[model samples]
Target chain A: MAALKDIIARDYGTPAVVIDLDIVTHNIARLQAACEARGLENRPHIKTHKSPELAAMQREAGAAGITCQKLGEAEIMADAGFDDILISYNLIGEEKIARLAALIPRARIIVAADNPVAVDAYAEAAKRAGKPLEVIIECDTGRKRAGVESVADAIALAERIKASPQLRFAGFMLYNPEDAVAQTQAFLDEALAGIRGLGLEASIISTGGTPNLSNLGRIRGTTEHRAGTYIFNDRMMLACGAAELADCALHVYTTVVSRAGPERGILDAGSKTLTSDIGGLDGHGLIREFPQARIARFAEEHGFLDLSASSRKPAIGDVVRVIPNHVCVVVNMVDRLIAVRGDEVVGEIPVAARGRIV
Target chain B: MAALKDIIARDYGTPAVVIDLDIVTHNIARLQAACEARGLENRPHIKTHKSPELAAMQREAGAAGITCQKLGEAEIMADAGFDDILISYNLIGEEKIARLAALIPRARIIVAADNPVAVDAYAEAAKRAGKPLEVIIECDTGRKRAGVESVADAIALAERIKASPQLRFAGFMLYNPEDAVAQTQAFLDEALAGIRGLGLEASIISTGGTPNLSNLGRIRGTTEHRAGTYIFNDRMMLACGAAELADCALHVYTTVVSRAGPERGILDAGSKTLTSDIGGLDGHGLIREFPQARIARFAEEHGFLDLSASSRKPAIGDVVRVIPNHVCVVVNMVDRLIAVRGDEVVGEIPVAARGRIV
Candidate 1:
């Protein structure tokens, strides 16, 4: 039986996530340098690669800590000796709270809470654990996914965190502001002012998104930035003008299994490997070898590539590399990623937190 | 240090794939009974559950064999003692061909080929293995995803398979016909006539799709039926009138992480857990508790639920069971599925072929 490692070593199969380590290193250095030049702490989100090795590389490149979307991810990073971790998602449920409390002693764990109910739950769990858990109040700066709506609401949540004996108020964390610099800065300034007016100190102000990473310096009050996809720029990032095609470090290696017609072919990579996130792009992913070919549709294990527009169409049994529309979700879909450097296989990194949805 | 097992055991986490065993049994029995009544061979596609235990149940319930989409899945099922297996996708590339050829000795393995290139590859591998491989020519019956274009094309491919030194032409396999019954029957009849006219024996005519299972009897030439999603019907199946809400065996157990606003809430389940396959449906999925609520949008780890249509809204920390837009992909996303019977935790089934995209 050929394991994933053997298959990757021999370049034996398709539908595998391949990461170029050199490109990854360059991407990390570029982002870290950008943040350092602006005097901002770069706490890169580990949700993209989810590898301890990659997270360690980021930390070595001067990242303050790591950011995770779930406690499961944070636990994996914490186990890997990442001392400072920020879970940017709303921490709800007793089970999750207990898990968060357990991580308090092992690492400098910080969690986000958008409401007082979440704040109270965190306080209760921390009190039970006999430890003080750092709480970051999530604020809505136009991204309506999660977070307190207004400055007053953010101040109220911050105050509740400050009032709790077991919870330490650790400033704010917003997902990704719609309007980058001015509006995000205004919202942060107002919320900070409101919190200070309540006689509490707001320390850390964190914001993230690869598209807005360049504008992090423009946002005046943010102390740290958390961008996951910057490590492995994708088609979405390229389309958003965040990175060029040359900056994409990870690519899905796939084989054209069937050429149904002159205009259409099917690749082994599908929604399972490449993901269905178009990210407002025209197609599912970008074929590096065949730039004009569009990933028209996807079955569970079949990516339908439209080769009508391409001057050079690949035959059945030919291999191609696809850059996914969204790299983070694609990373979450696979178990391991093969890391390469200029055609030579360096090593393989297990996506430690691949399916850590909890 | 809570593992997935511990989390599932305590029912402590959200965004878990919960399988109702009773419903699974019923679904298996119902589909088998239908096929039995119509004298059609039930080769249930194992791509849905991908569990050896469930496959055994299906086989015991009178499934003639099992169907898989990848060589990896075939190897797993073959290891689990399933002797008769049909891999529906075209087997290309040396590695996959070698794997398929290896399965030939262990199981009565059959593979599909839409073109001569794949047929030649299969023949080469089977010849190298010194085994006669059963080869089925995939026919295009309207779904242009795979298979040969016309009846003549399918017959040509079948002739190519018959002429191979180590291949046995096993007849045709058509993807779910867009227009069932009349079109399917016509397509099958024409393809059969063409192959017979070439003095080749066309033994097995296999056709499959969950939507066309009820009309399988109407397609006169089809000897076998392959359906995957009928085991755990999804929202797409319900919308296509394939199954009812009560028939859906699987549900995504998710927690309301944040009530973003009065009319909006976020669930822990997102594209990572539930998939972005809307399948021509309106929303991402259907929340069983709040039938009127629409899963409006999804970030990688967050599902935005629009509660504006619902009279009752769930608060943060509340659990909601969601029937995903597509269950097959959802099953492929998770590592293990928690099986339950009337609120009692029966057991857990590891998704043996979860990431078997290769």
Candidate 2:
């Protein structure tokens, strides 16, 4: 089989997600080393790559386990022989609960929940399945997206889990904080204090974000770090000083299909491939070959690149690699990642959990 | 099999794309009737639904053919027994050309190109396959995304196609214009004048956009209107006054997974499900039940719904139907669409060409 680099030069198609395996290996090693140096358990989130094969690479690099955002993703990872998994989303519905329960017997399944309804449902499902599920109380440190608003709510949920025979109070999980060390330490200190007051010991404390991965030691109470995007850094990571441009492992190989104007051109990849994730950036993504060119706009199947800033413009049929704004969402958009090592197609890693949105 | 409406009310999973077959049938009939009344052919673009079953429904509704944005999509449509297929994209590379060549024998494959390089490649591929490929000169009407800038350039490409033995000059293709009728008429008139001046005939003049579908008749010299989103009108269409909310056929069923605050809750659907296609709207999507609510932001798998404006807020696990800003990109995000009709799941339609980006 032609290496991915050769495939791109030869028979490879445009608008395809190509992963640099060498970079991925280096990324995994670097992040793992950082966590190890901090004495933090590195549970890399598989939601970034969504590939069990890549997860195995993380595991080989000394990751304690893996993290997933959904039960469907956890199921995919579990089926691929990953025994320890943490589903970081509050899973609801009987179908999802039943699926979660099914995974408890096969893997060391840990789930996060903030509300009583989800906690009750998870307890019931675990009881019905005759398996004790490890439950994590998700606390909202600053990011108002999900999790309990206060440490009291986190303690309350942890107490409820401690009181349940089917659910075990494992730890607390929080995401995306400006000051991870200070915010997470405060949240964990209060929650842990409350848990200790209730005669309970918290087994784990997790805080994760690629932007804060290197500063895990400063997060006083965090025992495990669950950073996902660090494994395949993107423009967002680069912007946040989490990773350099060279640390980005994935790139969408696209062909310039039409030069609409001297300063404008269209690529085969668009919203469907590169995605609409601005990631707090100005444009859609960065064109590696034409750094000055801006991916100004995207239709579903066409990426409009503004080449006016470039001294030399590319002609039609020229292939350009784009580093997406958010690599995780971009990874989930495609079916498989074409793994390449120095212009050689090393392997084809199927995105095992690409659209497992349940 | 139960109807989709019943499925949504009962066993359907949240964050799944549900298409009401009744609305789809009605939307298809309504648009087809409008095109028929104007004596224009309606070739609905399959890029929105990406399902053969839906395309068959379109064919049953008297569609002239189907429109695909990618050759991979055209190949899928061709395999499903659709003969007249127009791939409105610049076909490039030996791999893509070979695939396009393979589809030529199976379907009446018509492709668009704005540059001579693409036209020459298509002609060469057609010659190698011993099949005459229908070539369309794409003109940039107003959407500065793709297509030749001027009528002279369009005629020049048309002339090249007319002179080629392997390539057939079929028509002119353009996409999304602010003033579709006036702009398309002017472009078509000039291109037609230029083609006639060169002693040639412009067989087909195709223009399409859901926003301008109603004004197809006013665009003189165009034989077919290729509106895709009319079959599943979205918030963009609703805003454009092209179609009412009643005409919308697709809805994403999502569950409230977290109630972060009194006026804020997170839905299970986010960028991965609903997509980041704001369609020039303020938010990500429109929640049908909570029209006053704003889909403020999106994480990869979580949609933050602002319930501050809504009189009533939903609790966790409550399913709400969200009509995406752009349905085409949302359709591409999922693996399957739950087909429902009047509260019953009629069937599960696989998104056959979901990730056929090549």
Candidate 3:
């Protein structure tokens, strides 16, 4: 076991992030095919991988466009030549709106605003831009994160957008968290009816979360969907019964740095890499192929793994792979990632939007 | 209240990581002063705020040196001309050891190895580098993270280090997560006594954790103490009664992007910015001045806040200040930070070690 560990270690090494590009491409195709099969557009949210390279792959896979949550993220995508992008999340403020206005001239930009105040803010910005800004009325679909309460609320917001010369109503967007497939579709159907019944065009009904995507075809009236974390399914997805462990593509490659006791050892990666996001899971993350090894604690630089529950006693210098609870948070932490295939270092991807936290 | 929020927003805007440099400098001085007053050397861990500029500031504030958990972080410090540094975590594998060996000649390199396997690995690297590597035995001081368990264990490890020509025994490094001050000294003292009882030199007694800093003065015969989160006191520190809100220097500047229901609104800064580090805390982060606004949910790019409890509604474009549960994680998420002084942008500091997760 030690020799095997060393061999694998020498091949991939420690303190590296390994991504199975094959799995990523597979996920892209599966997601795109699922959405297109449902007669909906698949606007791959670049926010997940935040890689123009990956976004291009999604575009090549028949994606209608890309979705961005931040203007910063959108700016990066636009710069990467992904012109048709949807700012899925809410956009606010003069600084952000000004950026949005500038982006509109170059890219086909659409955004969401859930309230009259935000609608007015966008209208004023659009008036300054001297063009109707594309707007999506957000609908609350049980997640309670954002969006208006019902179709009436959404229509009221859309009507406000329609009244404003600075803004044009485009569609609706809702993100449900770890939602069951049936529940998400039901909520979307209910919300969309109210919007479409208003005699206004709610052409775009966007809804996507990995858990809900398994039955995306069953959902009625959703013309497009946005799901990000599906590119690299994490422990949370596995825990939620959304993805299989074998489907996970990203892992924090950590070396056993310490054997504090027979029961305890420290891994090179910590909250800085695995992240402090439990994502409602039992522990920080799932130690790939080392289920019994519990993540007992996390310092900024080292993760303490209690391996007594497991039958194996891992020696120091052994490389362990950790599938983080939330893949997206882990992605934002690194400067670059080592792309590997079966212990071979083939290439490196500069985490282009690694720290576009703004 | 709206005026105050607007003042804060206009004065301190969104997508910005606000660190009152003045407060930071004071906090550094305060910690140094405390450590000095306790007759202990302060080796502030560079992990909390991975900025070499801040490390230099800490050194200038009377820190004996800086402690880094990663070799990459150590390299960043060395690049900043910081010589006397401690790579507090373990050095593993030939490649990492080779990197460590290369760094040893450039800086006063001190590393820890808790197991025989890792110790020998470092020893071989040190021998190859022709530089004496100071090795500290990490003791599992109630944290259960890393370190030797008993006096016998400590003595055995110290003897092993003494036997290796490349590895020099340099006291002990105990990461006391549970109770750094209370339990650390007794356990460390016993271990050191047992090591000295074995006729081996037990010199430096280092222990740390931001939470235990207040009781640090109680620990006797402790030569040096290391702490990182003390500089940028987080919500966790505040929750643990370790630091005050005023002591917290890092805050994420965000804006209210969408208001759905009466009480619900979405914040621009989410998991990607503030991170999903609940860390035994109730919410994602503290709303700094707005204690009533509860961050109920956090997406990768949006934080859902329930603002119904507040006296007034946080309109779109209005900025809100959030003190993250873990400031360290948030700092690692961004590349460059805009330092401001009352709406005036003072300067932009590159997060020198921003993505050194590896």
Query: By TM-score, who's the top model here?
Result: 2
Give the range where candidate 3 chain B is weakest over 10 consecutive residues by summed lDDT: B4-13
lDDT of 2 by residue, B1-358 (tens): 2344335634656678888899999999988998899888888999999999999999998999999999889988988999999888898887887877777889788888999989998998898789898888898977898899988788789888888989888878867475656766777888888888878776778878888875677777768889899888899999999988889888888889999789999999989998888778899888887899899999999899889999989899887888899999999988888877776667889999999998
Q: Comparing candidate 1 with candidate 2, which one achieves the higher DockQ?
A: 2
TM-score of 2: 0.97
Off by over 4 Å in 1: A1-10, A178-180, B1-10
Candidate 2's docking class is: medium
| lDDT of model 1 at position A136 | 93
User: Model 1 over residues A1-358: C-alpha lDDT tens digits?
Assistant: 1243345624647778889899999999999999988888999999888889999999998999999999899999989999999999887777787787788888888889998778988898798778898999888777889888788888888878888889898998976654656767778889888888988776788888898875777777778889999999999889878999889998888888888788999998888888787678898998888999999999888999888899999988777788899999888887888888865788788999888888
- Give me the displacement of residue B17 in model 2, in angstroms: 1.0
- Candidate 2 chain A lowest-lDDT run of ten: A1-10
Question: How should the candidates be ordered by lDDT, best one leading?
Answer: 2, 1, 3
For model 3, the superposed segments whose C-alpha errors exceed 4 Å read: A1-13, A176-199, B1-13, B177-183, B197-199, B308-313, B341-344
lDDT of each: 0.85, 0.86, 0.77
Candidate 3: give the clashing pairs. Answer: B138-B147, B139-B147, B139-B148, B140-B147
TM-score of each prediction: 0.96, 0.97, 0.93
